[model samples]
Target: MAAKRRRPAGKGAGAIGCAPFFVLIVVALIIQYWWVLLIAVGVVALTVALVRSTSGPARPAKVPPPPRPQPVVAPPRAVPTGEDLTAQLRAHKRISRVRDMQEWDYEWIRLAHPGKSVREVNDIANTHFARGRSIGINWGDPSAP
Candidate 1:
């Protein structure tokens, strides 16, 4: 004869039976300890509020510091002024005049004797320079005049 199936004895009814009782106990405890639950919730809310407040606004990934100011200093030389400034300007003008005269002399020589090479121009000017010196007059270079 085949053995008839027997149900597992205690497992079925006991676990199912305990669920409502457990739920009823938890509901009773919650009613009695309501203030504790409130306090726990308040603590969690306070922690979240503090964390958010302390975090503040989002910041840039990297911030470069402002550059340091450099000390402004006068140049290491004295500023030319008064007679010194005048002399400096006058010397520059005289040098410029000498350059102008030399340029004019070359142009004049080139025009006066067309087809003369530069070497011939130098020779002509040198030959004429000593002639006017005896008369206390400068020649070749019109710079002195």
Candidate 2:
């Protein structure tokens, strides 16, 4: 013989039974004093407002004043001496032989000829390097004897 299936108890049954009870209570309260419903709605709105206001950081009603601008002052420039210039040139030449010169090389040359453009400084530096080469200045590998 096959076993008979027993139904699951009290899942939706409790909610169905409580629904009528809740409806009756609300109806009784409405009949007794309608103003109570309005008061309940007002209290719910007040509660929501209080919760939202306290939930996060408070914002200012007006925007804060724009930040004050800081003054920018230029530092004093130092002039390179003849010995300093010669030393810098020698250092630059040693570096150039190792690798092809870049924009930074022209920038270094610009430090010596302050008013000159990058192209002009490059030309001037190239002339100096060429002149050194013609004079047989050893601007190659320092490791070489």
lDDT per residue for candidate 2 within 36-96, as digits (tens), equals 8889999999999999878577676997899999998898778778999899899989888
lDDT of 1 by residue, 72-131 (tens): 988899889999999999999987876676667656766888888889988876665444
Give the per-residue Cα lDDT of candidate 1 at 19: 86
Q: Residue 36, candidate 1: how far off, in angstroms? A: 63
Error of 2 at 142 (Å): 30
Q: Supply the TM-score for candidate 1.
A: 0.36
What is the TM-score of each predicted model, taking all chains together?
Answer: 0.36, 0.25
List where candidate 2 sits over 4 angstroms from the true fold.
1-4, 10-15, 36-71, 75-145
Off by over 4 Å in 1: 1-75, 126-145
Question: Once model 1 is optimally superposed onto the true structure by TM-score, how far is the C-alpha of residue 55 displaced, in angstroms?
Answer: 55
What's the true lDDT of residue 48 in model 1? 93
Q: List the residue pairs that clash in candidate 2.
A: none
